[model samples]
Target: LAQEGQFRQRSSSCHCVPTSLSMAVRGLKAVALAACALAVAGKVQLRHSSHKAADSSLHVGSFVTPLESKHQLRVCNAFANSAAMDVFRGAESLTAETPMPYKSCRDFDAPLKSGDKLEFRLGDASSGTFSVADLPNNDAVLLLVIHRHDSVSGAVSFESHVFAALESAQVAVIDTY
Candidate 1:
């Protein structure tokens, strides 16, 4: 308790403390929280009043059920050669903004709405731009796999495979030639 008080006092009043890294980390956390809040707000707005009323019946401590109405996108990095892979969502780099990539696998997942075009980059190796409307409506989840391919012409390429369950659908194989 005494050590905790000292830490609080020093952090609150000490001007000589070098806390730039910690401050930056805190700022990034704030940004991420704000983004999450905005997403929740958007979902709330889209939901009907009947849904809201139905939600009130559930116990307070119970887990909220996830809505599967929106199309789900899962980007997987199956490329074994690269030490690490970076993923980008639009102009913002998803891997760069999130701290989870450093501790876990380099992958991204998001809810994509119909007619919304999602563009992403897989480091410098591969990139793709596709709309939710383009994907088959039969599958709820769209899997985008980043993989390596060695051509007979002594060329290395990154191919993206869209998978529905165990079946592979070759939608786009972008050549970085």
Candidate 2:
């Protein structure tokens, strides 16, 4: 009887270890699955936020005329609230009828004036050389012309006008690659 009872105890002890090991493996698998789900959700959220930001920024590549879009920005110094340009681009002057693409770095409470010579250029999407020239007939705005002379295979020139800066001027950047 004593021998038989010892044999039974040993058999039960061996069974208990495998059952414990199986439970441990099941718990580890559950944790790994949970971690994977969290990672995938995070990636999806990141992509969603990026797309949202892109929608708001202006795309300089999409518009043939920069002034035609709502994203047109101009930077300049201002007076009583009316724009008074000192440094005009693509055009020597501005008018209510002629819409120019630009943004001002100064206070928006005043008007935009481009009196200062502001360093300006089209963003990287430009493919051609843009020249700022004078038109004899129109003194109100400078004539900005894009020439294909230095254009690579698929590039076009775009221009922005700066107007109101007592000392300096700047354009607002919408996006970067």
Candidate 3:
């Protein structure tokens, strides 16, 4: 009985749970942490989204046909600091923005057929994203892929806005055929 009375007295002096302000402060901290995490994820998602592109142009056939067996092709690659990727139709020429040459993935979105004898201009050195044409400074290397779909003469073909990207500490030609 004495011990119970003493314990009750001791606990009676401390008649406090967490204060409302303290709880509110903790809730604010939790919300801040959640926001930070979401911001980071959103940034990552944006970068990844850049790497992808949607089909904007219709493949009506090429304005010019491939007269020679080998078509002059080029692709604008930015695979070194940037990942240069584009989906093209009737691709006779490609240009590059960086010096790094990308490994060929015939159809980035889809698969390549037997008729698709796409040319890939690889870097003699650095196996990275490169383009053939260097706009201001000679930096990009272009991949010259051959794409020819036989149709009527008065036809036009081009890939839609089929491109997206993700900036990374390092981005390489992970997939190539």
In TM-score terms, which candidate is top? 1
Each candidate's lDDT (Cα)? 0.44, 0.32, 0.31
**Candidate 3 or 1, higher lDDT:** 1
Q: What's each prediction's TM-score?
A: 0.34, 0.21, 0.20
For candidate 2, the 10 contiguous residues with the lowest summed lDDT are: 1-10
Give per-residue CA lDDT, model 2, range 5-74, as digits (tens): 0001112223323566668869998997798667766665665566655475532222222232111222
Model 1 regions more than 4 Å off: 1-68, 97-109, 113-133, 151-177
* Model 2 TM-score, all chains together: 0.21
Model 1 TM? 0.34
Clashes (backbone N, CA, C under 3 Å), per candidate, total 0, 34, 48
Candidate 1 residues 129-172, lDDT tens each?
Answer: 44444444334455544444443332222233333332333333
The parts of candidate 2 lying over 4 Å away from their true place are 1-17, 53-177
* TM-score pick, better of 2 and 3: 2
Ten consecutive residues with minimal summed lDDT in candidate 3?
A: 1-10
The parts of candidate 3 lying over 4 Å away from their true place are 1-18, 52-177
Q: Which candidate, 1 or 2, has the higher TM-score?
A: 1
